[model samples]
Target chain A: MLQSIIPLAVDALANAALIFFVAVGLTLVFSVLRILNVAHGSFYSIGAYVAASVGLWIVGAGLPDWLTFPALLLSAAFVAALFGPIVEKTLVSWTYGKSEAVQVLVTFGLFLILEDLQRIVFGIQSVYQDTPMTMLGISEIGGIVYLNYQLLLIGLAGVVLVALRLFITRSRTGRLLAAVVADREVSEALGIDTQRMFMIAFTLGVFLAAIGGAMATPTTGVAPGLGADTMVLAFAVAAIGGLGQVEGAAIASIIVATAKVLAIYFAPSLDAVAPYLVMLAVLLVKPYGLFGSGSTRKI
Target chain B: MAHRTSIKTLLAATALVTSASVAVAQDKPASLDVGVFTFMSGPAAAYGMPGRQGAEVVIDMINAAGGIDGVPISATFVDEGQGAEGVISEYRRLAEEPETDFMIAALSSGNCLALAPIADQMEMPTVGWNCDSHQLFADAEHPYFFRPNGNTIAEFMAYVIYFLDNNPDVERVAIINPDYSFGHDAAEIVKASLAAFKPEVEIVAELFPKLGSSTYQTEVSRLSAARPDVIFSNLWGGDLENFVRQAAPRGLFRQSQAVFALGESSMNNVDMPEGVIVGVLGDGWWRSPDAAELGAPEFAEAYQTKFEKAPVFPAMKMANAFMVMKAGYEKAIEANGGAWPTDEQLTAAMEGMTIDTLTGSMTFRADNDGIVDQVVGMVGSVEGIEGPVLTNMVRYDGDAVLPPEGEDPMAWIASLTPDFIAAMPKPGSYE
Candidate 1:
């Protein structure tokens, strides 16, 4: 019984670690910007493509193997630095004061454009770079061999969660961003730079999503249509955890990933629809989500 | 007056003779327009692009050899990545064009099933270059569409037979197929074959991951926990590559005997470990003895020179489909006394036809289904070879594994027994 349960727990946590990044980013953007970023998943896939390409080039150039690890982080940083501000300033800012429907429409259109742009830049074939995974080697857990990179992801996710909490509670910029999320007009009246906070919040969200994609490159194949697949799952996670809640997103990632892993292990046929089923169940019970409140503003 | 009457009679007879000759012969066109369908984008393109390249190379070769009866072949490619509705729309759009003579359509089995009846409805002669679903011709017959490679029944069964022959003590089996008709049908066939040959063998786990999935780590863990003696999968294209890449690091292959039904396609792209069971769905291995003897090397060489890579089984299958199509057209033209044949004439000529392909000889059954050998082998490194090559190969007779016509394939497989398995050839017999 212990043996079986150990494998199940490890699988669920490893699966959750990847989803948490994108989900947290989606929730963060929603909390600050007050608009659902439907194109958030595109950032993740772009980061993955960039990381795979850079990693391949590094290895192809006979660079040191340890550099591939830093390349992953640097690639995510590059994608975030490049796409985050430009997208937030241009098409995203245009829909700032519009209706929710307008914001969603604009972002969905952005998703389509970004998806096509990725195909043009990355081509149609899948890109794989496993140097980081191979260099770390393997470990036997619960009597089954698993890549140490997978375990590292679980730890990294925890680190990100703690770091994000500290940043939000202790940092000056984070407090201002939270102040804006609390009441944009009140924060603006208090001499807070609300527009700058929105930009900072959006860029940080892109970093989170991009880092998630970059970390996944070692274990997954980065290919066309990956943005769509990741986007759907991230939406489910956000919905289940309560949109705009970072802690909720983290917990929801585990719930959603566990549902998916359980379905794969037991029913097998329900693997594709398991995450959606969880979302449906959660929403049916808590209309505002697990952590969301209809009357109170919280981030 | 008698001289005038004689001249009029002579002119009338001349008109009658000219009309009879026109009725018996058709004016040959300047070129043959063929609509080729395969995936050109997305993950499946990893498998589909090779097929498209194969079509290009084969068409170039055919056109260079003074063309088919001196008429060049002009091809327009349709990307199957755009879902079935778009594929159907494109097929209709191309079929309505008067100049379109033939179609070598479809890489996905789902697309093939969707387009088969449409081919008959439009009266277009189409060849299924890589679709191998048994369900395509299970219930209804489509005269217009022909598949010159054996279906999932023979393809999956050949793997089971070969693996069982090598590992006679194998008991527990786990399956990880893609969640589609092709994958599910292959799983069913694999299970049926196992039940027939080894009754005590238990299915420890069965996982059907969705097509185009980027990761298989969870499924890999599930497979590992099952601890089966053998793990079987029919995942192809990038899905196969991803699975092999992820699972190899997790020591899954080291623990279990892995059987990849469409494995040869990724052998060039991925570093598949030695001793893993692999096969070309049919006998499309370019390095196989039969394929080597039939000019597959030359075709592969041209393919490498042009595409900058070796030809996988999908490419070889596409080339073979063109060979069969060429044979069909030539036979129809011969039967028509050197005139271009109509669509019905082409289909009729292909019925029960036997022709040589770049891989091996394929015979079209009465129902326009094909009979080709199944080559199963293990991935092994040969001296001076860059990547993995098939070793310890067995070429199963196509007819020996195929179910008889008008019989339910599953029931036929269930009827098989260990005695029947004993009568079949062993692994490494064809080498």
Candidate 2:
């Protein structure tokens, strides 16, 4: 039992690490921008595609293998830098003061366009670059062999959580973003440039989602529908974590991952619906989620 | 001013066409129009794009060789990732347009089933390039729909017989297949085959994960926990690739013997670990002895040159589908005294026809199911090859696994005795 538990925990943490990045980014965007980026998942897939492309290029060019590690991060940053401001300024900015329905519809349209763009750019084949995974090597934990890259991901998720907390509480830009989230009209009245904050928040959201996708590419193969699948899962995590709660997303990711892992271990039939089942159970118990409440914004 | 000019431009174009038509009498278009359907998006595209690429190569080859009856074949490919309803809508839209003579309809069994009835209604005389499900012809037979690949029953039962021969001492088995009718039906056939061959065997675990699922971490854990002697999966395309990737790192292969029915299709794309059981659903392996013997080396070399990788089973299947199409046309033309046969004549020619493919001979059964050999083998590293390849292979006869005509497959398996296994060929016999 102990041997099995160790591997299960490791698997759960690895699963949660990927889920946390996408979900927290989604929640953060919702909190500050006050509009759900239905296209957030597209950024994830785009990040993966960029990372795989870069890694493949590095390999094809006969460059040093160690460069693959940096390629992952560079790929995520490239996607965030390229897509973030353009999408936010040109398209997402229009949804700033619009209704939720309009925001969703517009972003969904963007998702469709981005999906087609990926097909045109990457073609309709599964792209994989596991050089980073292989480079990190393997370790035995709890009687089961695991990729060290997976363990690094869990640690990275922890660092991101701490770094985000510090940014929101201790940093000037973070304070301005929080002010905008609290009261957009008041922030504008104070001449705080809430529009800029919305752009920054949305861009940061794209960065986080892209990083999640980049990190996941080492373990999971990237394909055409990856963005949509990630989007649906991220939505579930965000909803269960209380739409705009960063900490809620963190806890909810673990909860959802644990549920899925448990279902896979014990009842294989429920593996697919395990996360939603947990969400249903939790939502039934707490209408606003565990950490989510209609009060001052919390993590 | 621009709008008026555009209208005047349209009138000028109409005048130019009228003058050109008068100058040259009636002539057929330079290229034959075909609407090809396969997966071009999503996880299924991992399998479908290869089919599309094969079509591109074969169509080019045909056009280069002066095409069929001297008409160049040009295709408009449709992505099956857009769900069945969209597929039906696209099929209807394409059918309504003139110039689409034949269709290689789908790769998904569900989509093929959906399109089969509609093909009959439209009188399109479509060919199913990769439809493996037996249920497509269960109750209703579509006159215009034809399959030149054997059904799921034949494919899955071949695995069962091969495994039984290879591991005569095996007692426990487990299945982890995609969560759909294809997966479930495969499980049923495998179980039935086992029950018929060795009733003492116990099924310890059966898992069905959703299609397009990226992570199989939990599935690996479950299958590991079960500790069955043998683990079987029909997860194909990206799902199979994902499972193999996840499971390889976790030591699942070291713990239990694994059987991936569609593993051969992914041998070159992924690093499939050594010693796992793998097979092409039909005899579509480009390097199979039959393929090597029957002028398939040229096709294989051309495919590799064009696609940058060796042709997998899906590519072979797609190429074979074109071959079948070409054969049917030739037979129809011959029967019609060297003239273009109507769609009806082509359909008649395809009925119960036997055509030799690159890998093996395929004979379409009266029930619209094609009978083809099933090749099963274990993965091993080849010295000269860049990656792992199948070794210790067994080629199961198609008729050995197929249910008798006009009989329910499940019922037939239930009535079989241990004598059936005793009579079947053993592993490595084909070589």
Candidate 3:
């Protein structure tokens, strides 16, 4: 049992690490903004595209190979800085106090526009940059060769989860954001800058998604239709984890990834629909998700 | 008396004009419109765009050489990436137009299956350019539809033969293919071929990953755990690129004899390791001696001058389809006594037609399925080319591998024997 379980665990954690990055960001934005940002996955793909471009430029320009590591983070920062505020101010802000359908439709429109824009800027062919992946080298686990870059991704995801926990609890802005989540009207009455909180939360969500996509550049190709695939998978994770629950998102990612890995190992036919099967089963038992309840209407 | 004579004279002139036009047709039109379908956007574009470029370059070459028998060819390229419904609708709309003469139908097997019947229904001479699905003609035969390339059964069996001959002591084999008809059909063929030649071969693992899947970390792990002696995959385009990038560093290729059935297309794009087995699905290798002798090298050079990249197999397949169509028209015209033929005449001409292509000759069987040579090779860094090129090549005769008409393809594969393979050309003998 242990022999079979080791490979499964390693594969699940590695897969979950990639999913957790985008899912948590999507959940975070939904929790704070009271709107499911359909365009969150677009930021993730944009980050991947930018990271691949920068990493390729670094290698082409004769820069130190180690710089590719920082290039990933820098690419994410660039995407978040450019797209976060502008989208939040124009599209996201307009959907405030609107019905869920309206908000979803509007962000869905934004998603379509971003998808076309990516095609125009990046062209139809896939973009790949694996300098970081190759530089980090390889390691063997459970008699299977694994990418050390993959191990790094697992560690990075853990670090992000912890850092997000600390930021939401210890920081001053964190307390304000928490208060707004608790009661937006009362937070405003208590002289908290709710608008600023909204912007900060949305930007943070964008940053998380962009970083996820950037980090994935070393393992996957950045191409058209990647954003939509990521978005659908992220939505599954977000739903399974209970919407707006950061820790829930992390745990849900593991469950979903585990399901997918198990399917690939034992049942290859169910590989594509494995995550959704888990979602269906989880949603059946707990209609509001594992960590969700009827009373958590703060969003 | 004058009115009666006038009526009789008019009747006589009308009858004469009708009878005279039947024997001597009008001159060829100023330009011919071709409906070309391929994926122009999205993930599949990685493969489909090459086919599109080949069409563009071939059309340009044809026009430069004074067009197809003096009629300038104009093409309307349709993006087949937009699902089968849209593809069928586009074909119907284009077929409805009297100006559109022929259709280079599609790059996808699914789209080809959908458009095949429609071609016959509309009396359009359509070629299945890049579609290799055997299922396209399994149940129904389209009079107007034809494929100038080899089918999946022969394509997959060639890989199995090569692998078995090289690794006689192989115990376990694995498969990782995309989750679609093309992928599933190839898997069936490979397994059947294995059972036929080497009954003791064990298929340790089989995985069907979703098309356009970005990551294969888990699939890689599963495959590694299986500890197979050989691994075969037919994943192409960006999916293949992603798999190569992820699996190479983990020593998958080094550990196992990796056989990428469609790897030739991405040999230029990916940093593929030498000694990995790859094939072009047909005799589309531009660098193959046969192709070079047949002027494929010149076509490739002209293609590179126009598209800025050397032609891959998809490009070769599309270009060959154009050649086959042009040959059909010329044959039809010849048969019609120096006059342009109708759609029915072209269909008749394509039936049981044999024509020389850039790669080799394609002879259309009575079933409208063409029998072309299958070429398989291993990646080697040739001194002349900038990137890895196919070496240790073997070209299998299509007639020997292809199932006879009206026979079940799987049963035909299962009947193949080791003695059967021994009589064929060995690897590295093509040169």
Native contacts recovered, each model:
0.83, 0.71, 0.96
Stretches of candidate 2 off by over 4 Å are A61-64, B1-32, B381-386
Model 3 vs. true fold: TM? 0.97
lDDT of 3 by residue, A1-299 (tens): 78778889989999999999999999988888888999999999999999999999999999999999999999998998899888999989999999999999999999999989999999989999999999989998888999999999999999999999898899999878888988889999999999989988888898999999999999898989898899999999989989989899999999999999989998999999999999999999998788866676433
Superposed Cα deviation of residue B69, candidate 1 (Å): 0.9
Off by over 4 Å in 3: A297-299, B1-27
Worst 10 residues of 3 chain B by lDDT: B19-28
lDDT of 1 by residue, A1-299 (tens): 99888889999999999999999999999999988999999999999999999999999999998999999999999998998889899998899999999999999999989989998999988898999999999998889888999999999999999989889889999888889989999999999988889889999999999999999999878888888888899999989888888899999999999999999999999999999999999999997789987776667
For model 3, residues B399-425, the per-residue Cα lDDT tens digits are 888898889999888777889888888
The alpha-carbon deviation from the true structure for residue B18 of candidate 3, after best TM-score superposition, in angstroms, is: 3.2
For all candidates, state DockQ relative to the true structure.
0.80, 0.52, 0.90
Residue lDDT tens for model 1, B1-431 = 99999999999999999886765576787998999999988889989999999999999988988777888989999999888999999999999999999999989999999999999999999999999999989999999999999999999999999889999999999999999888888889999988888989999999999999988999999999899999999999889999999999898999999999989999888879999999999999999999889989999999989988889999999999999999998999999988987777889999999999999989998888899999999999889977789999999999998899779999999999998879888888876
Instruction: Kindly indicate the candidate among 1 and 3 with the higher lDDT.
Output: 1
What DockQ results for candidate 2?
0.52
List the candidate numbers ranked by DockQ, top first. 3, 1, 2
| lDDT score at residue A55, model 2, on the 0-100 scale | 91
Clashing pairs in 3: none
